[model samples]
Target: MTPNAREMSESIHEQMPRLLTELAAVVGTTNVLTKPSQQQSYVQGALEAVTDATVAVVIPHSLVALWRVINICAAFDVIIIAQAANTGLTGAQLRMEIMTGR
Candidate 1:
């Protein structure tokens, strides 16, 4: 099983704000959604919808931003669930309530 944020490192709470800022900067603020309502649609599968568990749903419109996002998440030890048009039927992109950055 994939470990949640708590199981990872306690340092994530301290790094999340900076991580978010960098993410927004790389992808633009409008593309980095932090609200539950904005996050919901991104976590849905073809059959069921998962609860919003992500601190932010970052949408990178370019490969450069996507690469930087991966790097930023690694630097912060944050888990990533990559989504593509939310068209998966097997819940592959459905993120669990596995992170607690705050």
Candidate 2:
């Protein structure tokens, strides 16, 4: 059966430390933004909505890095939401939680 929200949250909480470390290794430590302060700009919406459920805001520097990031998230069963640099007409980024276990 599919894991419930609470179970998924707990599982992700347990795996986050390792996941962050591995993600940092793949994308470089500088590319991984874990703190809310550091990640705020990335997830900020056009209408002033801010999603605080992000685990980390990973900024991949290249196609290779992006590919690796996808693989890592897939391995951890994490969700991903790709956003353009300055586009959010539909508030897409404000929707689902990226890298969230749920």
Q: After superposition, how far is residue 65 of candidate 1 from its true place, in Å?
A: 0.8
* Alpha carbon deviation, residue 93, candidate 2 (Å): 3.3
Where model 1 places Cα greater than 4 Å from the true spot, the runs are: 1-9, 93-102
Per-prediction TM-score, please?
0.75, 0.83
Residue pairs with colliding backbones in model 1 are none
Once fitted onto the true fold, the runs of candidate 2 whose alpha carbons sit more than 4 angstroms away are 95-101
**Candidate 1 residues 23-46, lDDT tens each?**
998998999999888877776655
Give, for candidate 2, the lowest lDDT window spanning 10 residues: 89-98
Task: For candidate 2, give the lDDT of residue 45.
Answer: 64
lDDT of each: 0.74, 0.80
What's the CA RMSD for each of the models?
Answer: 4.8, 3.2
What number of backbone clashes does candidate 1 have, counting pairs of residues 3 or more apart or in separate chains?
0
